[model samples]
Target: MDKSHNLERHLMSRKGEHNYSATVIWTGNSGEGTKHYRAFSRDHEITCGSKPTIKGSSDPAFRGDSSRYNPEELLLSSLSACHMLWYLHLCADSGITVSNYSDHAEGRMIETQNGSGHFEKVLLKPVVNIGTSDDKDLAKSLHDKAHSFCFIANSVNFDVRCEPEIVVG
Candidate 1:
């Protein structure tokens, strides 16, 4: 079977728009509720379809609860997960069997003197375990393709760098 035909078929199958939605309900109303900067909590709930609700808050440095997930963490998670999913798909297309995968992703943000901030870059350190040793190079190269195809990575303004470690197990 020709790989190009398979690639064309795969590309053809993805010709439609994909839509997603989520709801965030603010749970922060401390009695006084925004009466002062310190008067309210920074808690919230995130829900989408039938998925379980996620407890969310601002980063602890901003007076939010340490126990809850912050937006920055969620953004990193989205980028990591999107890249992993695309990598797995491309691996399957390239005849590489991925046995295990994990990523330790990190991002850097810079805050301006006026209180605005933006992520400057994100690093995705993926440890991918493949079923055979013959395709180690191919496995490592797939991370680049995955990063290119990742919707979340493509949507972000900062650089999403991939440093994938391929291991045969």
Candidate 2:
């Protein structure tokens, strides 16, 4: 029940490594198959085992369908989801009873003159609602640890900043 014991148990349970995989199938081929620059579509499908296929496409700036999910948006969503999951886990282990949690994350990408671009920064604004008994300071402090442990955040070259707000409910 104590903090130290809980932290120790949490650390001990994650000693093993993990692996993940996914498949992307291009469904474009608008009957021409890249014969010209505008001949083919950028539509594709992403699948992971038995899960539902995610409709994917290039950004509309690249002549893709605006109705589909773009790669840039997916990358930002991955980072946001990873951070939120780790934060919730850490809160549970640390005895912070979170009633509600939400994040409005944003990412900024800069395109170069050569038509290539990279994400410059990502801001994760997490608003956490915790039980009245929880320590608000401790809840706020956990965001740093969560970001440090997030796999997607650690893999990205751009800076990922967390601006968390803690509310006792």
Candidate 3:
């Protein structure tokens, strides 16, 4: 069996149905339940199995706590994380030898006059450091494939663009 054939088989084996679940517990009672729109807090906690609970709140623009993680930020984070994970896996399979990877991701949302809004896009700026033997062009080209395979990016309606800077050390 050839290396390419083994890699193809491994990749194919990774494809299948997956199920995810999360529990969101609202923690913002403040002694009053949604008696009025302005009467309750918008704080909550998101837990998934044994992982650390993520403290979440509505965007500060919606009268939520500015110190907590907001849904919008989480959405952007999901996209960025999904892309980075896929990129790293693809790099490993392609022998890119990544030493370090970091992303400064940003997202844009446009709110309408009626208090409705939608994400316009997300830009992922990944600074990747690879081994000296790795092909920089190949590393750069892998981002497009990574974006295509990213579960979060595929599920989103807005654009998720990856502008990666590959540095060979």
- What C-alpha lDDT, on a 0 to 100 scale, does residue 129 get in candidate 2? 99
How well does candidate 2 score on lDDT at residue 156? 94
Which pairs of residues collide in model 2? Answer: none
Which lDDT value does model 1 have at 163?
93
Q: Candidate 2's residue-wise lDDT over 1-169, tens digit each?
A: 7875877787898798888899999999999899998999999999999999999999999988899999999999999999999999899888899999888999999999998999999999999999999999999999999998899999999999999999998
The sequence of per-residue lDDT tens digits that candidate 3 reaches over residues 17-61 is 989999999999877799889989999999999999999999988
TM-score for predicted model 2 compared with the true structure: 0.92
Which regions of candidate 1 are displaced past 4 Å? none
Per-candidate count of clashing residue pairs (backbone under 3 Å): 0, 0, 0
Whole-model lDDT, model 2: 0.92
Give all candidate RMSDs, comma-separated: 1.2, 1.6, 1.6
Q: Model 2 Cα displacement at 60 (Å)?
A: 1.0
In order, the Cα lDDT scores of the candidates are 0.92, 0.92, 0.92
Specify the highest-TM-score model's number: 1
Which ten-residue region of model 3 has the weakest summed lDDT? 1-10
lDDT at position 109, candidate 2:
94
**Which pairs of residues collide in candidate 1?**
none
